[model samples]
Target: MNIQLLANVIGHEKGKKILINAFQNNKLSHSYILSGPKGIGKYLLAVEFSKTLLNNKSRQASPDLMVIQSTTENKKHSSININEIQELESFLRFTSANNSYRIGIVDGVEYMNYSAANALLKILEEPGNKTIIF
Candidate 1:
């Protein structure tokens, strides 16, 4: 897919071009961080990339894609905990059932606590054939 054309954008043409070029050249890294101001569609971009990579019509139904988000408790800001990271680790244990690439999207990664970050770091240290977008 021509992601640069398929995905809608508002500014950040340079960043979009970089991602599209990486996809076209088969040079995407094992892990990446999409950090910027809020309401800039980072989540949407991640989902689009995941769908394109997995060739899934519905991002939620894709077996090869996992989208992780931070949790909240008592109306207060909470963090992504170690349990979530462990779940991601378990998800990574299996290969893509559809022969497509396995992808993990960690939304709002800055909300991850120290332990969770450490767990994710361990996963990144030996990413195997999986791709993670933070």
Candidate 2:
């Protein structure tokens, strides 16, 4: 395992160890929830984990990586809608470029509306092969 990937993150030692262990053992789950208070490096940890899983230097450029976040429309309230969840489902349906894992990260999932939450749950219940969502 490459400890350097998570070297920059402050604190969260147990979380880091768990992620590394899962990667090393090939025991990663289909979904994971990193719940805690705000500004505790949850997003940073998730990004690092995604990078490690994808084995790519750039998460934004990786075809196997999909990141979903809440969108604020017209400066009103922020939300994750059903459309975003559906997009994730569609993304997972495709084959990976190199027979690798397809990783999806949903940031601020608490902002998802009821319909979106249900949609995401449906995907979680029937996640595709080699597809993981966090």
Error of 1 at 76 (Å): 7.1
TM-score, candidate 2, is 0.89
Local accuracy of candidate 1 as per-residue lDDT tens digits, 1-134? 64643455666667677777887888888877777886797877777767777777653578877778866543354478889888888887789888767788887777788899899899989886755544
Clashing pairs in 2: none
- Show where candidate 2 strays beyond 4 Å: 72-78
Cα lDDT tens digits for candidate 2, 1-134:
56787887889899888888887898988888888997798988888877776777653668988889766543344488899989999999999987898988998887888898999999999999999888
Name the runs in model 1 displaced over 4 angstroms: 73-77
- Backbone clash pairs for candidate 1 read none
Best-fitting candidate, measured by lDDT?
Answer: 2
* Predicted structure 2: lDDT: 0.84
Candidate 1 has an lDDT of 0.75
TM-score of each: 0.85, 0.89
